[model samples]
Target: MSLPLPRDLARALAFFLAPLLLAPLALAQQSGAASPPPPAQGATKPLPVFEIPQSGVEFQTGDTWGQNGQTFRLYGIQSCIRGTTFTNPAGAKLDCGEASIAYLAALIRDTKPRCTAVAQTASPPLIYTVCAAHVGANTLDLGTVMVTQGFAFAATDANGKPVNLQYAVAEGEAQKAKRGLWIARDLPHPTAILNKALRDAERAQ
Candidate 1:
């Protein structure tokens, strides 16, 4: 006949078996196979890098269209303009044309200081350079970034020359931070607007 085990030996056996029961659970935590963290509020992620080939672009100026507002002299391919997120579907370009006055308004609002003067010309079409991609990084103020397909127009006469409308990217120099003119460089593309604005500002001094 076998003798009964001591109480201390039984307690030790139970302790050793405890981790065995929870091993899979512990492994999961250590391997970091858990759910992803949620996104923070108002985060503006950097957009992808997209460039409009200089060739596919076309230029036209003058209030031909019965539209009113700021113009974005485009240098890239003409993208179809959907309605603003407020009035129409956010990204639907069904009835919209190639120009976006709302975008220019927003750009002017945010970049008033640097853009002391924003006017249209009747000559060479202005070049609107779109970053290779959309703005990424949702960490910025949603009100500070304008998320839309990009476009630009002629800032001078039909001579195809660079007019004052030619802008540069002015990173961190904006005093108001309008969402339209604001290019979230936090994304991975070269922002010609910000770059041009910065250059213009530097030259002004």
Candidate 2:
């Protein structure tokens, strides 16, 4: 066994080592260098958001698709789930999910939006992304269009809280205006459906 460090020797070593250990931070602070803000709780660092190629792009739903063997979804929007229906003004029932998918596909065709992948999720390895498209003289975030136009919804966690709060604001405006799917009296909200599913799964467990 090694001999215990003498109290005086330990004190002397610490006194001499403290300044060396602290010098870089002190110098950085003195030079006005700033450290990057820490990532949000339970959040990963976002990947670089470069323009994704349009080749092999396929629309799987209103808010998700596959490209180059990778699945990608809009960062803050949820498409209506398949098998849901809503009423039109003629009292005829329309498939809400199909409508969302159709609208998204049309927008993609017309606008040819460019996206930047930001994060990835597991279970099938889905990428979350933000996209932009030009409409007239203005460039718009694609999620804003999807939610604000009432075709899609502000995406939420299992707790029913929006993943991106700004999308919630847009959704509110769309709701107040009663646009697109919002005009239907029987629109089945994705968040409601998802939350119910979560609760059901928990109860089953």
Candidate 3:
């Protein structure tokens, strides 16, 4: 009932995820850690950390964005790939990837989360981060919210090993609850599509 991931994406995931696999930050974690200790008395004050606003920010997928001329994705979240389709209740096909993008856009617009750089990939430059947003006086992980609500999924390698076990847990719960994208019984998982593409590519080798 499950499919594998492609090698390229798997490797990309590793760079963004290896650190998380070893140590996951506690819930409500923010970019405060990036802030240096206050300057000594009378010393020049350090500049406050800058924040990026979600307004007009472009989304590459449900979990990725184009930032600073590079790719920025949530550390352990994978959105559906673009161009995939699923049928709606009205018997019309809808773009699953676009649906994911829309959901993420809504979440960003409503939550205004703040993210800190957690990892990066060489060459192409993919910045990975963990973001938290305030909801009802409680700060929550953005990736957790997306996966738990079924708008995104836990990032995994080609063999299906998850980056963060907790994200896998969230995804499982969402699936069980049939939330968001899970509501479509015939939903086409992005990883499955990638796996098939990989297999086909390998066969042609």
Candidate 4:
């Protein structure tokens, strides 16, 4: 049997179909609202920097020499003696080695501040004793800063065992030297310093 369609029913169906066709537009608007915007490209934060004392030593990025603003290392210059070692605070031993103070000092004086450096050592009671000026520029980097200081040690025999020997280390250059420093004991020579200390100790006893 054939049935007749109602006019109201046809109008309601058209209205519902019109909204269904526009559902994609509604979904697009909802998606835009739900997502966050992308961050700006090439944006970056700056690095932080801190200041240190002007007189303080500035070490290289990977340097192990400096601690609490002071830096130090072992230096070697030509010496006349043999078979001696100085123990560091860390319990490591350095053979005093040997070098000429006159030669080492001259080298330091002639060398350019940032271009050249003589290796040497400086510890308390004998600070910066290896170099002439007690300060030098780093050869590896011109911008890096360094200072040398002299120290005196009571000279002993080939072993670290102390004797009545007093020695003065002349200032030399930047960097650590295997020869230690050219040392003067009592007079301008290494022998005098060792002899003086031994004589003095004997007299005291």
Model 2, CA-based lDDT:
0.68
Model 2 lDDT tens row, 112-173: 88786654544335566678987988889998999999999877654456666778999999
| lDDT, each prediction | 0.27, 0.68, 0.68, 0.27
Model 3 spans > 4 angstroms off: 1-50
Residue 165 CA displacement from its true place in model 4, Å: 20
User: What is the alpha-carbon lDDT of model 4 when measured against the actual structure?
Assistant: 0.27
lDDT of 1 by residue, 42-136 (tens): 42332112322323222221111111222223221112222211223343322222234444343433432121111122221111222222233
- Which of 3 and 4 is ahead in lDDT? 3
RMSD values, in order shown: 28.7, 17.6, 7.7, 36.3
